[model samples]
Structure formats: structure tokens, C-alpha cells
Target: MPTHFIKLKPSAVDEYKAIHAAVWPGVLAALERAHIVDYSINHYPPLQLLIATMKYVGDDYDADMKKVAEDPETQKWWAATDGMQESFATGATGSGKDIPWWTEVEEVFRFEGTS
Candidate 1:
């Protein structure tokens, strides 16, 4: 299994919080079916930033992303909330990427005190 991490700047804290408060049911189901496990998002209030992590356990990551993208309900859900996001330079406008609202990062540590 490999872990992916990403970060995004929220258009507004309340707007971001509201959508996450009730993630759409269809999207949630798609996430599990696509082998996305242990997903989570953390926030930095002062910076209005969000960091997300998802674990994937498969050889073909692109296949999983395709499954997620192909779901009709997931598409609808994204359409409704797309405007609430603010993209960083790397984000594609109205085009889906590995992470919808965030940019990926290279992992530098696993356990804080392992060394």
C-alpha cells in the first residue's frame, strides 16, 4: 500500500467546512470501491489550508482514478462544489487531476520519532 498526500487553499473556511460536513454518499461509496482507504483531511485555520491523505493498495493508480471519475453521481457532486475551491498554480481549471483541489507532495517522514 502507498500513501498519497496533498494540500489546497480553501476559498473560504466555512465553504470548505460545509461541503466536508456532509460528503456525498455516492462519492463515499466510490472511494471505498476504488480501494481508497483511510482518507482524511486536516485544516490549518490561520492559513486557510487543507491537507489530505489517502491510502491506495493496488498496482494501477490510474485505474482507480478512472473508476472515481466515471461515477455519474460523483460527477454531479463535483459539479455542485467545484466553485467553492480555489486552485493553486498546479491545478487545472475545470479539469480533474489526481487530487481535485490540492497538489501532491513527496513524503519525507513516516513516524516522527522513528529515527
Candidate 2:
């Protein structure tokens, strides 16, 4: 499972929430095809940030991501959503690696309940 932290532009927060409120079926299908399960996106109004958590069951993360990226419907969805996101640079030293849209976050702690 991977958790991603991303920030939304102040102006785009509302629209971003609205769009996800009724996610497109094609987009959902694409995610399933990519072996992305238990995906959830949470919004923090005060910070205007979005936290996305998902479980990746696929063996090849990069390949699955590429497959999802190549999907026409997914591309269309991103076209509408990407503009609403804020991009992040790798680090303070001006690293060439730019996090695309969602910045990856390292999970510090986790707790599971036993039934």
C-alpha cells in the first residue's frame, strides 16, 4: 500500500472535490486495470491539500502506471484534473526529478485492529 500527499490550488479545491464526487466510470475501470485498489482521496480545506491512499497489488508498479497513463479515458480525465493540482520539485537543491501532480509521502506509522 502506498500513500500519496498532494496539494490542490486554492482556486481548484472546490472543482477537484466536485469532480471526484462523481468519478467517471472509465476512470474507475482504468484504476482497477492498473491493480490499484482501496483508493481513497481525502481533502483538507484548511491546507487545501489532498491525501490519496491506495493498495497496489500488481507486481510491476511502473508498468501498471504506464498502462494507466496510456489509457485514453484516463488521459482525458487527467487533462481535466491535472490543471487543478500543484506540482512539487524533488528537493531544495533543484533536483531534476519533479513529482507529477501528487507528491509521494513516506508513511511514518500505521495501526491495524484485530478482530
- Candidate 2: tens digits of C-alpha lDDT, residues 48-114: 7788899999999888877887888988888888778766634422111234556778888988789
For candidate 1, write residues 1-115 as lDDT tens digits: 3433333345556776788899998899998888887788777666655667788875678888788888988888867755665556364564255544545667777864856
Q: Each prediction's TM-score against the native?
A: 0.75, 0.83
Q: Rate the local accuracy (lDDT) of all candidates.
A: 0.68, 0.78
Model 1 residue runs over 4 Å out of place are 1-11, 95-101, 112-115
* Clashing pairs in model 1, backbone N/Cα/C closer than 3 A: none
Q: For every model in order, what is the number of clashing pairs?
A: 0, 0
Alpha-carbon RMSD, each predicted model: 3.7, 3.9
